[model samples]
Target: MHNSIERTPIRAHLTDHMVIVNAQAVETGPTRRPAAVLIWSTTDQKIAFSDPKGNLLFEGKAALVAPEVIRRLRTTDSTFFSLNFEPGNRHFLPLSRLVARQDFMPLKFDRFSELSDELQSRFELADYKGIEELSDELALTLLPRTNAKHLRDERIDLLLPLLESNQPPELNSLAQMLHLSKDRLSHLFADDIGMPLRSYVLWRRYRRALLALQSGEKIATVAHRVGFYDHAQMSRTFLTLFGYSPSILKCPKFIRISGIQSN
Candidate 1:
């Protein structure tokens, strides 16, 4: 008989405005690890994600993802609990990298058709505490140096800073400065990051919009400030991302991102 495997805690990146909690639980034998949980702004709900932790996490490492179609991994059956984090985009990761995945599967970790055993084990569990640590570990570990893709790195670098700017710049300008065609830029983004540039842009913007709302801004004002099309636009994206409306997440209301609100 084999002894049970135990995992330590990991780190996660965070915004001054937002907080991220890592996945925590213990399960045994093949079980579904929790995917991502996104909480958008105040609308109907935010679009929760279960994708690759984004390209930033796969920087300069030689890790492995479970392949494209494998989907989520099954927790050891002996006894294992999980602690899931929230609010990020969704992407399919190979065993080289560690990321949150969805339920849809032919579950896999390392090589497919070889589960209910020890094959796909990649995350650096240091100390299971909070979000900042998890985000940091993720950023540091997953995103190592792959190759010389300055533009790709540069583009991703823009995100944290751009979001911090008082008046964040638009995408077209960045594309222009990079001296690359729009399609080409998008292609590079997808290549390095997995998802298209526009998709991450949306996630980044929506994250900001939610922050504004959390600060007690009006719907219209928050929408305008965060560069949304309008309140309706914010509302729709909120619902899409969080699975709840914007008005509900207010501080006093204090809505939890995990629950499903009834009509």
Candidate 2:
């Protein structure tokens, strides 16, 4: 099994709701991500995931892993794609339900084969618009069409902008603004957003930092702008959540990052 990060350039597509990475090869050590991740082999080869101790957890063409599930991926020379959904994204709740509290769930390829092929082609061509459209379609295909309703809560809606801002409100301040006790607000947020409020806030900060770094902002500047106390803190968070040090961004040969253009 390959044990080091692939040296070939990988493509990364980023948006507010999700991130898509397409790679020709990958071998990651144990990683526990903050957002839900769906990984599949584009060449239809089976990928192997194992625990830190080398115990086999899953072997399949595709798998949806829940947030905070630690696993390592090892694959042969097959093309691979991964889609990561932020906790507060519209598609997150539906996808989480599919996992249903399990560490990981295997998915059938017949349903996603055609769409995945198109998405991989778009990625290779760097077609951002096509990539965005196909990503939503692929997400929808994974969900139960009959039950895919947009989840909205007015209270939660009011809080999102504030949390995404440079100076996010404290939990107590947010609770007061929503006119609910702290505990009540927390529960309501979890129900509507599919994650606790604190986790969502951290994710927002991380997302913002990632975008800034991709645009060539210095690490320390990004840390301060995104509410981290210092560059070290931000780097540590990046390592924990993404399984890589933020310093990796300095090497342009490793990956190419692009964001979806706003409509």
* lDDT value, residue 201 of candidate 1: 57
Per-candidate Cα lDDT values, in order, are 0.38, 0.78
The C-alpha TM-scores of every prediction are 0.47, 0.88
Best by TM-score: 2
Over 4 Å off, model 2: 1-6, 148-150, 260-263
In model 1, which regions exceed 4 Å deviation? 1-13, 16-19, 22-130, 134-152, 155-172, 256-263
lDDT of 1 by residue, 106-147 (tens): 212222112111211222322223333333344333333662
Top candidate when judged by lDDT against the true structure? 2
Tens-digit lDDT track of model 2 for 175-244? 9999999999999999888778888887778777776776677889888988888999888888777666
Residue 48 of model 1 has an lDDT of: 22
Error of 2 at 211 (Å): 2.1
